[model samples]
Target: MSEHSIEDVTRVVDGVLRSRRSLRAYRPDAVPRAVLEDILDVASSAPSNSNTQPWRVHALAGAPKQALGAALLAAFRENTLPPSPHFPHPLPEEYAQRQRDFGAVYYRTLGIDVADMPARLRQTEKNFGFFGAPVGLIFTIDRRLAPHSWLDLGLLVQNVMIAASARGLGTCPQVSFARFHPVIAQHLAFTEHELTVCGMSLGYPEHDEPVNRMAMPRRGVREFACFDQFE
Candidate 1:
Protein backbone atom coordinates (compact mmCIF):
# COMPACT_ATOMS: atom_id res chain seq x y z
CA MET A 1 0.00 0.00 0.00
CA SER A 2 2.12 2.87 -1.30
CA GLU A 3 0.88 6.29 -2.45
CA HIS A 4 2.43 7.87 -5.52
CA SER A 5 3.28 11.59 -5.61
CA ILE A 6 1.97 13.90 -8.38
CA GLU A 7 5.48 14.09 -9.89
CA ASP A 8 5.72 10.29 -10.04
CA VAL A 9 2.35 10.04 -11.83
CA THR A 10 3.33 12.78 -14.25
CA ARG A 11 6.54 10.92 -15.13
CA VAL A 12 4.54 7.80 -15.90
CA VAL A 13 2.19 9.78 -18.13
CA ASP A 14 5.14 11.25 -20.01
CA GLY A 15 6.65 7.81 -20.49
CA VAL A 16 3.38 6.47 -21.93
CA LEU A 17 3.09 9.36 -24.36
CA ARG A 18 6.69 9.01 -25.48
CA SER A 19 6.28 5.33 -26.14
CA ARG A 20 3.25 5.68 -28.42
CA ARG A 21 3.67 6.00 -32.20
CA SER A 22 1.64 5.31 -35.30
CA LEU A 23 2.86 1.74 -35.83
CA ARG A 24 2.43 0.78 -39.46
CA ALA A 25 4.44 -2.42 -39.58
CA TYR A 26 3.65 -5.05 -36.95
CA ARG A 27 4.90 -8.44 -35.93
CA PRO A 28 2.83 -11.43 -36.98
CA ASP A 29 2.31 -12.54 -33.38
CA ALA A 30 -1.27 -12.40 -32.20
CA VAL A 31 -2.18 -10.08 -29.35
CA PRO A 32 -4.03 -12.02 -26.64
CA ARG A 33 -7.78 -11.52 -26.37
CA ALA A 34 -7.52 -10.82 -22.64
CA VAL A 35 -4.95 -8.07 -23.24
CA LEU A 36 -7.18 -6.42 -25.82
CA GLU A 37 -10.16 -6.51 -23.47
CA ASP A 38 -8.17 -5.03 -20.60
CA ILE A 39 -6.91 -2.13 -22.75
CA LEU A 40 -10.46 -1.44 -23.94
CA ASP A 41 -11.76 -1.52 -20.37
CA VAL A 42 -9.25 1.17 -19.50
CA ALA A 43 -10.43 3.20 -22.53
CA SER A 44 -14.09 2.93 -21.45
CA SER A 45 -13.16 4.71 -18.22
CA ALA A 46 -12.81 7.96 -20.23
CA PRO A 47 -15.36 10.64 -19.35
CA SER A 48 -18.38 11.16 -21.61
CA ASN A 49 -21.29 13.55 -21.93
CA SER A 50 -23.88 12.73 -19.26
CA ASN A 51 -21.92 9.48 -18.86
CA THR A 52 -23.59 8.32 -22.08
CA GLN A 53 -20.39 6.61 -23.33
CA PRO A 54 -21.70 6.62 -26.88
CA TRP A 55 -18.58 5.01 -28.35
CA ARG A 56 -19.11 1.67 -30.02
CA VAL A 57 -16.16 -0.50 -31.02
CA HIS A 58 -16.05 -3.51 -33.29
CA ALA A 59 -12.85 -5.47 -32.77
CA LEU A 60 -11.89 -8.11 -35.30
CA ALA A 61 -9.20 -10.73 -35.53
CA GLY A 62 -8.32 -14.02 -37.27
CA ALA A 63 -10.14 -15.02 -40.46
CA PRO A 64 -13.04 -12.61 -40.21
CA LYS A 65 -10.67 -9.71 -39.84
CA GLN A 66 -8.61 -10.87 -42.80
CA ALA A 67 -11.75 -11.23 -44.88
CA LEU A 68 -12.82 -7.71 -44.01
CA GLY A 69 -9.45 -6.35 -45.07
CA ALA A 70 -9.61 -8.19 -48.36
CA ALA A 71 -13.09 -6.88 -49.12
CA LEU A 72 -12.12 -3.32 -48.35
CA LEU A 73 -9.13 -3.58 -50.64
CA ALA A 74 -11.42 -4.71 -53.44
CA ALA A 75 -13.62 -1.68 -52.95
CA PHE A 76 -10.62 0.64 -52.93
CA ARG A 77 -9.34 -0.88 -56.17
CA GLU A 78 -12.69 -0.19 -57.78
CA ASN A 79 -12.36 3.51 -56.92
CA THR A 80 -15.51 3.63 -54.85
CA LEU A 81 -15.65 5.79 -51.75
CA PRO A 82 -17.90 4.69 -48.94
CA PRO A 83 -20.94 6.72 -47.99
CA SER A 84 -20.11 9.20 -45.28
CA PRO A 85 -22.88 9.61 -42.75
CA HIS A 86 -21.88 13.15 -41.82
CA PHE A 87 -18.68 15.09 -41.28
CA PRO A 88 -17.38 18.61 -40.88
CA HIS A 89 -17.22 20.78 -43.97
CA PRO A 90 -14.53 23.33 -44.87
CA LEU A 91 -11.81 22.42 -42.38
CA PRO A 92 -9.89 25.52 -41.26
CA GLU A 93 -6.75 26.37 -43.22
CA GLU A 94 -4.40 25.79 -40.31
CA TYR A 95 -5.90 22.41 -39.60
CA ALA A 96 -5.81 21.52 -43.28
CA GLN A 97 -2.21 22.69 -43.56
CA ARG A 98 -1.11 20.43 -40.72
CA GLN A 99 -2.74 17.46 -42.40
CA ARG A 100 -1.08 18.28 -45.69
CA ASP A 101 2.29 18.62 -43.99
CA PHE A 102 1.94 15.22 -42.41
CA GLY A 103 1.10 13.68 -45.76
CA ALA A 104 4.09 15.32 -47.41
CA VAL A 105 6.46 14.07 -44.74
CA TYR A 106 4.96 10.60 -44.78
CA TYR A 107 5.26 10.21 -48.51
CA ARG A 108 8.75 11.65 -48.62
CA THR A 109 9.94 9.28 -45.93
CA LEU A 110 8.56 6.42 -47.99
CA GLY A 111 10.60 7.74 -50.96
CA ILE A 112 7.44 8.47 -52.89
CA ASP A 113 7.89 11.55 -55.01
CA VAL A 114 4.88 13.69 -55.89
CA ALA A 115 4.93 12.37 -59.43
CA ASP A 116 4.66 8.75 -58.23
CA MET A 117 0.91 8.36 -58.09
CA PRO A 118 1.02 4.57 -58.43
CA ALA A 119 3.37 4.24 -55.49
CA ARG A 120 1.23 6.57 -53.48
CA LEU A 121 -1.86 4.53 -54.25
CA ARG A 122 -0.10 1.34 -53.26
CA GLN A 123 1.01 2.84 -50.00
CA THR A 124 -2.51 4.03 -49.31
CA GLU A 125 -3.80 0.53 -50.09
CA LYS A 126 -1.74 -0.79 -47.21
CA ASN A 127 -4.18 0.88 -44.81
CA PHE A 128 -7.08 -1.24 -46.00
CA GLY A 129 -5.06 -4.30 -45.10
CA PHE A 130 -4.42 -2.98 -41.58
CA PHE A 131 -0.74 -2.79 -42.55
CA GLY A 132 -0.47 -6.53 -41.77
CA ALA A 133 -1.58 -6.14 -38.14
CA PRO A 134 -3.46 -9.09 -36.67
CA VAL A 135 -6.19 -7.05 -35.09
CA GLY A 136 -8.39 -4.31 -36.60
CA LEU A 137 -10.75 -2.12 -34.60
CA ILE A 138 -13.55 0.04 -35.94
CA PHE A 139 -14.74 2.92 -33.78
CA THR A 140 -18.31 4.00 -34.32
CA ILE A 141 -20.90 6.36 -32.89
CA ASP A 142 -24.66 6.70 -33.04
CA ARG A 143 -25.75 8.95 -35.89
CA ARG A 144 -27.99 10.84 -33.50
CA LEU A 145 -25.06 12.15 -31.46
CA ALA A 146 -23.77 15.72 -31.88
CA PRO A 147 -20.25 16.82 -32.82
CA HIS A 148 -19.32 17.06 -29.13
CA SER A 149 -19.88 13.32 -28.75
CA TRP A 150 -17.20 12.75 -31.38
CA LEU A 151 -14.81 14.67 -29.16
CA ASP A 152 -15.78 12.38 -26.30
CA LEU A 153 -15.05 9.39 -28.53
CA GLY A 154 -11.67 10.92 -29.37
CA LEU A 155 -10.84 11.09 -25.67
CA LEU A 156 -11.84 7.46 -25.35
CA VAL A 157 -9.50 6.64 -28.25
CA GLN A 158 -6.64 8.52 -26.63
CA ASN A 159 -7.20 6.54 -23.45
CA VAL A 160 -7.05 3.32 -25.44
CA MET A 161 -3.78 4.36 -27.14
CA ILE A 162 -2.12 5.42 -23.89
CA ALA A 163 -3.23 2.30 -22.05
CA ALA A 164 -1.92 0.17 -24.88
CA SER A 165 1.44 1.92 -24.64
CA ALA A 166 1.55 1.12 -20.93
CA ARG A 167 1.20 -2.54 -21.88
CA GLY A 168 3.95 -2.50 -24.61
CA LEU A 169 1.37 -2.53 -27.40
CA GLY A 170 1.37 -0.13 -30.35
CA THR A 171 -1.64 1.34 -32.16
CA CYS A 172 -2.34 3.31 -35.34
CA PRO A 173 -5.59 5.29 -35.50
CA GLN A 174 -6.58 5.14 -39.19
CA VAL A 175 -9.09 7.65 -40.51
CA SER A 176 -8.42 6.27 -44.00
CA PHE A 177 -10.72 3.40 -43.10
CA ALA A 178 -13.60 5.85 -42.98
CA ARG A 179 -13.47 5.84 -46.77
CA PHE A 180 -14.57 2.21 -46.67
CA HIS A 181 -17.07 2.44 -43.84
CA PRO A 182 -19.91 0.99 -45.86
CA VAL A 183 -17.86 -2.13 -46.59
CA ILE A 184 -16.84 -2.40 -42.96
CA ALA A 185 -20.37 -1.92 -41.62
CA GLN A 186 -21.80 -4.38 -44.09
CA HIS A 187 -19.22 -6.99 -43.18
CA LEU A 188 -19.61 -6.39 -39.43
CA ALA A 189 -23.42 -6.22 -39.54
CA PHE A 190 -23.64 -2.68 -38.22
CA THR A 191 -26.97 -0.89 -38.52
CA GLU A 192 -27.47 2.22 -40.64
CA HIS A 193 -27.83 4.21 -37.42
CA GLU A 194 -24.18 3.59 -36.55
CA LEU A 195 -21.53 5.71 -38.26
CA THR A 196 -17.94 4.58 -38.47
CA VAL A 197 -15.79 7.37 -37.13
CA CYS A 198 -12.39 5.77 -37.57
CA GLY A 199 -10.46 2.51 -37.32
CA MET A 200 -7.30 1.35 -35.52
CA SER A 201 -4.66 -1.29 -36.07
CA LEU A 202 -3.27 -2.74 -32.87
CA GLY A 203 -0.30 -5.05 -32.41
CA TYR A 204 3.40 -5.16 -31.60
CA PRO A 205 5.44 -2.96 -33.94
CA GLU A 206 8.14 -4.31 -36.22
CA HIS A 207 11.11 -2.33 -35.00
CA ASP A 208 13.30 -3.07 -37.98
CA GLU A 209 11.22 -1.14 -40.48
CA PRO A 210 12.64 2.26 -41.39
CA VAL A 211 9.19 3.70 -42.07
CA ASN A 212 8.30 3.08 -38.44
CA ARG A 213 11.40 5.02 -37.43
CA MET A 214 10.08 8.31 -38.76
CA ALA A 215 9.21 10.58 -35.87
CA MET A 216 6.55 13.18 -36.51
CA PRO A 217 7.56 16.66 -35.40
CA ARG A 218 5.38 18.60 -32.96
CA ARG A 219 5.16 22.32 -32.19
CA GLY A 220 6.14 23.75 -28.81
CA VAL A 221 3.43 24.43 -26.20
CA ARG A 222 3.89 28.18 -26.52
CA GLU A 223 3.33 27.96 -30.27
CA PHE A 224 -0.02 26.21 -29.91
CA ALA A 225 -1.21 27.68 -26.56
CA CYS A 226 -2.09 31.17 -25.34
CA PHE A 227 -1.92 32.31 -21.77
CA ASP A 228 -4.58 34.75 -20.63
CA GLN A 229 -4.41 37.20 -17.71
CA PHE A 230 -2.35 34.68 -15.71
CA GLU A 231 0.66 35.27 -17.92
Candidate 2:
Protein backbone atom coordinates (compact mmCIF):
# COMPACT_ATOMS: atom_id res chain seq x y z
CA MET A 1 0.00 0.00 0.00
CA SER A 2 1.29 3.47 -0.94
CA GLU A 3 0.57 6.68 0.95
CA HIS A 4 1.18 9.15 -1.87
CA SER A 5 -1.76 10.48 -3.85
CA ILE A 6 -1.71 10.07 -7.64
CA GLU A 7 -1.31 13.81 -8.12
CA ASP A 8 1.60 13.88 -5.70
CA VAL A 9 3.36 10.99 -7.45
CA THR A 10 2.76 12.50 -10.87
CA ARG A 11 4.09 15.88 -9.84
CA VAL A 12 7.24 14.38 -8.31
CA VAL A 13 7.90 12.10 -11.28
CA ASP A 14 7.34 14.87 -13.83
CA GLY A 15 9.57 17.23 -11.94
CA VAL A 16 12.37 14.65 -11.83
CA LEU A 17 12.18 14.07 -15.57
CA ARG A 18 11.96 17.76 -16.43
CA SER A 19 14.87 18.70 -14.17
CA ARG A 20 17.20 16.22 -15.86
CA ARG A 21 19.66 17.73 -18.38
CA SER A 22 23.06 16.83 -19.75
CA LEU A 23 25.34 18.84 -17.51
CA ARG A 24 28.73 19.86 -18.91
CA ALA A 25 30.31 20.92 -15.63
CA TYR A 26 30.15 19.32 -12.18
CA ARG A 27 31.31 19.95 -8.63
CA PRO A 28 34.23 17.89 -7.27
CA ASP A 29 32.34 16.58 -4.26
CA ALA A 30 32.05 12.79 -4.22
CA VAL A 31 28.67 11.09 -4.30
CA PRO A 32 28.41 8.59 -1.46
CA ARG A 33 28.89 4.98 -2.59
CA ALA A 34 25.57 3.95 -1.10
CA VAL A 35 23.75 6.56 -3.17
CA LEU A 36 25.33 5.33 -6.41
CA GLU A 37 24.39 1.76 -5.51
CA ASP A 38 20.83 2.78 -4.80
CA ILE A 39 20.52 4.62 -8.12
CA LEU A 40 21.76 1.57 -10.00
CA ASP A 41 19.42 -0.69 -8.05
CA VAL A 42 16.48 1.45 -9.08
CA ALA A 43 17.66 1.55 -12.71
CA SER A 44 18.05 -2.20 -12.92
CA SER A 45 14.29 -2.53 -12.88
CA ALA A 46 13.99 -1.05 -16.38
CA PRO A 47 11.99 -3.32 -18.66
CA SER A 48 13.73 -5.57 -21.17
CA ASN A 49 12.39 -7.69 -23.96
CA SER A 50 11.79 -11.34 -22.95
CA ASN A 51 13.41 -10.58 -19.62
CA THR A 52 16.83 -10.72 -21.26
CA GLN A 53 18.04 -8.00 -18.91
CA PRO A 54 21.01 -7.30 -21.14
CA TRP A 55 22.82 -4.37 -19.61
CA ARG A 56 26.29 -4.19 -18.09
CA VAL A 57 27.59 -1.20 -16.16
CA HIS A 58 31.11 -0.35 -14.99
CA ALA A 59 31.19 2.49 -12.51
CA LEU A 60 34.51 4.23 -12.02
CA ALA A 61 35.67 6.52 -9.22
CA GLY A 62 38.89 7.70 -7.63
CA ALA A 63 42.19 6.64 -9.25
CA PRO A 64 40.77 4.16 -11.76
CA LYS A 65 38.49 6.75 -13.32
CA GLN A 66 41.33 9.25 -13.66
CA ALA A 67 43.63 6.67 -15.18
CA LEU A 68 41.08 5.55 -17.76
CA GLY A 69 40.39 9.19 -18.73
CA ALA A 70 44.10 9.87 -19.10
CA ALA A 71 44.51 6.93 -21.41
CA LEU A 72 41.56 7.96 -23.54
CA LEU A 73 42.75 11.57 -23.68
CA ALA A 74 46.17 10.47 -24.84
CA ALA A 75 44.57 8.36 -27.53
CA PHE A 76 42.44 11.30 -28.62
CA ARG A 77 45.45 13.61 -28.76
CA GLU A 78 47.32 11.08 -30.90
CA ASN A 79 44.30 10.51 -33.14
CA THR A 80 44.51 6.82 -32.42
CA LEU A 81 40.91 6.24 -31.48
CA PRO A 82 38.73 4.50 -33.99
CA PRO A 83 35.46 5.80 -35.34
CA SER A 84 32.41 4.51 -33.48
CA PRO A 85 31.32 1.42 -35.37
CA HIS A 86 28.03 0.82 -33.58
CA PHE A 87 26.17 3.92 -34.76
CA PRO A 88 24.85 4.62 -38.24
CA HIS A 89 27.55 5.91 -40.54
CA PRO A 90 25.49 8.65 -42.16
CA LEU A 91 22.90 10.42 -40.09
CA PRO A 92 19.64 11.40 -41.83
CA GLU A 93 19.39 15.06 -42.83
CA GLU A 94 16.75 15.86 -40.21
CA TYR A 95 18.79 14.23 -37.45
CA ALA A 96 21.97 15.99 -38.59
CA GLN A 97 20.20 19.32 -38.58
CA ARG A 98 19.03 18.76 -35.02
CA GLN A 99 22.56 17.86 -33.91
CA ARG A 100 23.98 20.93 -35.59
CA ASP A 101 21.37 23.12 -33.95
CA PHE A 102 22.18 21.67 -30.54
CA GLY A 103 25.90 22.27 -31.08
CA ALA A 104 25.26 25.85 -32.06
CA VAL A 105 23.23 26.60 -28.94
CA TYR A 106 25.54 24.66 -26.66
CA TYR A 107 28.66 26.46 -27.83
CA ARG A 108 27.01 29.84 -27.84
CA THR A 109 25.89 29.38 -24.25
CA LEU A 110 29.51 28.81 -23.24
CA GLY A 111 30.49 32.10 -24.98
CA ILE A 112 32.33 30.10 -27.64
CA ASP A 113 32.22 31.54 -31.13
CA VAL A 114 31.71 29.25 -34.12
CA ALA A 115 34.98 30.49 -35.56
CA ASP A 116 36.96 29.28 -32.52
CA MET A 117 37.89 25.81 -33.67
CA PRO A 118 40.51 25.26 -30.96
CA ALA A 119 38.07 26.06 -28.21
CA ARG A 120 35.52 23.76 -29.73
CA LEU A 121 38.06 20.95 -29.89
CA ARG A 122 39.05 21.59 -26.30
CA GLN A 123 35.47 21.43 -25.21
CA THR A 124 34.99 18.16 -27.04
CA GLU A 125 38.08 16.80 -25.34
CA LYS A 126 36.51 17.51 -21.96
CA ASN A 127 34.24 14.52 -22.56
CA PHE A 128 37.24 12.29 -21.93
CA GLY A 129 37.59 13.69 -18.41
CA PHE A 130 33.91 13.19 -17.58
CA PHE A 131 33.49 17.00 -17.50
CA GLY A 132 35.16 17.01 -14.06
CA ALA A 133 32.56 14.70 -12.55
CA PRO A 134 33.75 12.51 -9.68
CA VAL A 135 32.01 9.42 -11.09
CA GLY A 136 32.32 7.89 -14.56
CA LEU A 137 30.23 5.01 -15.84
CA ILE A 138 30.68 2.78 -18.86
CA PHE A 139 27.90 0.66 -20.31
CA THR A 140 28.26 -2.48 -22.42
CA ILE A 141 26.27 -5.29 -23.94
CA ASP A 142 26.88 -8.72 -25.39
CA ARG A 143 28.40 -8.32 -28.83
CA ARG A 144 26.14 -10.94 -30.39
CA LEU A 145 22.90 -9.31 -29.25
CA ALA A 146 20.67 -7.96 -31.99
CA PRO A 147 19.64 -4.35 -32.43
CA HIS A 148 16.57 -4.91 -30.27
CA SER A 149 18.84 -5.52 -27.28
CA TRP A 150 20.53 -2.22 -27.95
CA LEU A 151 17.08 -0.64 -27.92
CA ASP A 152 16.40 -2.39 -24.62
CA LEU A 153 19.71 -1.06 -23.28
CA GLY A 154 18.50 2.46 -24.01
CA LEU A 155 15.62 1.94 -21.58
CA LEU A 156 18.06 0.99 -18.87
CA VAL A 157 20.23 4.02 -19.60
CA GLN A 158 17.23 6.32 -19.39
CA ASN A 159 16.28 4.73 -16.09
CA VAL A 160 19.75 5.38 -14.72
CA MET A 161 19.65 9.07 -15.67
CA ILE A 162 16.14 9.57 -14.35
CA ALA A 163 16.81 7.71 -11.12
CA ALA A 164 19.93 9.80 -10.54
CA SER A 165 17.91 12.96 -11.13
CA ALA A 166 15.34 11.83 -8.57
CA ARG A 167 18.18 11.60 -6.05
CA GLY A 168 19.55 15.10 -6.77
CA LEU A 169 22.44 13.92 -8.94
CA GLY A 170 23.23 15.08 -12.46
CA THR A 171 24.30 12.90 -15.37
CA CYS A 172 25.58 13.25 -18.92
CA PRO A 173 25.47 10.34 -21.31
CA GLN A 174 28.49 10.56 -23.58
CA VAL A 175 28.49 8.70 -26.88
CA SER A 176 31.93 10.15 -27.51
CA PHE A 177 33.36 7.42 -25.29
CA ALA A 178 32.35 4.84 -27.85
CA ARG A 179 35.13 6.14 -30.05
CA PHE A 180 37.68 5.04 -27.49
CA HIS A 181 36.27 1.59 -26.84
CA PRO A 182 39.64 -0.03 -27.18
CA VAL A 183 41.08 2.26 -24.52
CA ILE A 184 38.27 1.40 -22.15
CA ALA A 185 38.56 -2.32 -22.88
CA GLN A 186 42.18 -2.09 -21.87
CA HIS A 187 41.31 -0.73 -18.46
CA LEU A 188 38.15 -2.73 -17.74
CA ALA A 189 38.07 -6.46 -18.27
CA PHE A 190 35.31 -7.32 -20.70
CA THR A 191 34.45 -10.83 -21.78
CA GLU A 192 35.22 -11.43 -25.46
CA HIS A 193 31.48 -11.36 -26.17
CA GLU A 194 30.94 -7.91 -24.70
CA LEU A 195 30.88 -4.61 -26.65
CA THR A 196 31.23 -1.14 -25.31
CA VAL A 197 28.05 0.91 -25.66
CA CYS A 198 28.75 4.32 -24.12
CA GLY A 199 29.96 6.18 -21.04
CA MET A 200 28.36 8.60 -18.60
CA SER A 201 29.45 11.34 -16.18
CA LEU A 202 27.67 11.72 -12.88
CA GLY A 203 27.82 14.22 -10.00
CA TYR A 204 26.23 17.33 -8.62
CA PRO A 205 26.03 20.00 -11.31
CA GLU A 206 27.80 23.30 -10.92
CA HIS A 207 24.57 25.26 -11.10
CA ASP A 208 26.35 28.59 -11.13
CA GLU A 209 27.91 27.81 -14.50
CA PRO A 210 26.17 29.32 -17.51
CA VAL A 211 27.09 26.35 -19.71
CA ASN A 212 25.03 24.03 -17.49
CA ARG A 213 21.92 25.92 -18.57
CA MET A 214 22.29 25.00 -22.23
CA ALA A 215 19.16 23.09 -23.21
CA MET A 216 18.16 21.96 -26.67
CA PRO A 217 14.60 22.39 -27.84
CA ARG A 218 12.48 19.33 -28.45
CA ARG A 219 10.06 18.72 -31.28
CA GLY A 220 6.40 19.18 -30.34
CA VAL A 221 4.03 16.21 -30.35
CA ARG A 222 2.46 17.60 -33.53
CA GLU A 223 5.85 17.55 -35.18
CA PHE A 224 6.89 14.04 -34.17
CA ALA A 225 3.67 12.16 -33.48
CA CYS A 226 0.61 11.01 -35.39
CA PHE A 227 -2.97 10.76 -34.12
CA ASP A 228 -5.17 7.72 -34.60
CA GLN A 229 -8.96 7.39 -34.35
CA PHE A 230 -9.06 8.69 -30.77
CA GLU A 231 -10.54 11.68 -28.97
Question: Each prediction's Cα lDDT score?
Answer: 0.88, 0.90
Best prediction by lDDT: 2
Q: TM per model? A: 0.92, 0.96
Full-model lDDT, candidate 2: 0.90
What tens digits encode model 1's per-residue C-alpha lDDT throughout 1-231? 149888898899998897688989999999999999999998999999899899999999999999999898999899768445443566678878887788888888888996789999999899887898888999999989899999999999999899888988888998877878778889999977898899999998887787788788899898978887564
lDDT string for model 2 (1-231, tens) is 189999999999999888789988999999999999999999999999999999999999999999999998899889966678755668888888887898889889988997899999899999999999999999999989999999889999999999998888899999988888888887898878878899999999998899888766889998888787558
- Give stretches of model 2 more than 4 Å off: 86-89, 228-231
**Top candidate (TM-score):** 2
* lDDT at position 101, candidate 1: 87
